[model samples]
Target: MQSPLRHGRAALGTTIATGALAALSQAPERASRLFRHRFPTVAVTGMTGVGKTRLADRLSRRASAEGTQDVGSAVMERRTRRDPRMRGYRFRVVPGENAATRLGALDEVFHDEPVDGVLHVVAYGHATPRRTAGTSGAGAATREEQLAAELEDWSITAHRIAGMAVRRDRPTWLVIAVTKADLFADDIDAAVDYYSPGSGSPFADKLDELRALAGGAKLSIDVLPVCAQGGGRKSSMPEKAATELLNRLELRLAQLSGHV
Candidate 1:
């Protein structure tokens, strides 16, 4: 029979040997973790009532719900055959243009953790018709003039956000989402033509003004219409718009990941 002291010493030695083996086995995993990179964070910023929260929820594939003034967070994930696991980006839904909130949010983003992109949302319905010289005079404003004026007014917020992104030390890609597309689905093509460059229209001039505001920032900008409403409606317009936004987002992510 073994003495109790001898048995205790043998047990201690076995425990030490097992721990050493475990540590050796985990060394490669620790090294791999050190080299692993995390997906970029995308910050969503827009004026109040622009459906920023709704868009975040939709992008995360969640059911649409009421939006809050407070900042919201969500994760957007995609699975690839090579990884066989879902990879994702963090989405931070920031509050609207309150100076304090906006500044605080940017401060956190810049100092704590930098974001890869900005999903700057602009609401179309908020663009109220602008009073025109023609209306105050002998003539009526043309539909094109009215639309252009409204868009220009609504564009100020988007341009401000874009300019901020451009001025950041590491300029982030900008995705301008013209949300609430369902309201004008019937005239989507007209809106697109009006917003596109070289359309020889005043609205086109406004778009140019926005691009100029970026001012040599090496950042990519894309504008697309979006509808946060769930797909099940008579017009499948919402589904189409959401899909387009997702495709654009994927392209931006690829660029960030150096896969493009």
Candidate 2:
């Protein structure tokens, strides 16, 4: 017994309410999409036990609870409460121990779908037992030999990245994170100088070659000294370094994305 006008008004109100509810339901997804568009994926790569995950944990303000080393790969999608602007970084961490996993991760991040940037981590003289094992199963390798092997690993990783850049025909932003700076706190400057570009070391030479291999594409490289776990149990160096690194990383990403 309702009038036509009243019926139409009721139907229209119902439609509007339904639409409002639908939009409200989709707000979170829409926000997620927007956040992803702003903050894209970044690959955190390096040799095993170099503190890549620890650094990511620190940057994302997540507790470093896992004592067991990462074996495969993981994507950290949580937004950091400490730096909201640094939120939403899809930090894909791949294992650096196994050759199969390392190559697979590199291909996933570089060959399959290239990420925004790469953080190639290194810990000076922090050789793992496996890495230091003698080729003939004789004994542990000498410290100098271990250091050489680490540099060789860095070379291989850098070359792979350069190859990917060439294939993608795009600029690449590479940050060489010299982690475990706390181990050499008394001579931090020397440590930084050792790994820095133009230091005349083999590492620097390899970096030069990497840049050359990039051809016309821009290769933005940075060497950062970091202590992902701080100098000691009570040191605040990790927090400070994490903050500085995040700030610099934001700028680097902005530059890479042409948002600068």
Candidate 2's TM-score reads 0.69
* lDDT per residue (tens digit) for residues 1-260 in model 1: 99999999999999999999999999998865433334456777655555677777666666654433222333222212122244455677665544466556656554455566666666544422323335543234454554544564446544555556566766556666776676677766665565555676665675566567765355566666666663654674657665775566556655664444
User: Against the unseen true structure, what C-alpha lDDT does each candidate score?
Assistant: 0.58, 0.68
Off-target runs (Cα >4 Å) in candidate 2 are: 1-37, 69-87, 127-142, 231-260
What's the TM for model 1? Answer: 0.55
For candidate 2, write residues 1-260 as lDDT tens digits.
99999999999999999999999999999997677566766778776656777767765667877664332233332323224455456677766665676777777887787776787777776544352434543235555665686787787678778877887655678887777766665666776677777888877778788888886357788777776654434564655654565566556656665555
Candidate 1: list runs displaced more than 4 Å.
1-37, 64-86, 97-99, 110-113, 126-171, 193-217, 231-233, 236-260
Q: Could you tell me every candidate's TM-score relative to the true structure? A: 0.55, 0.69
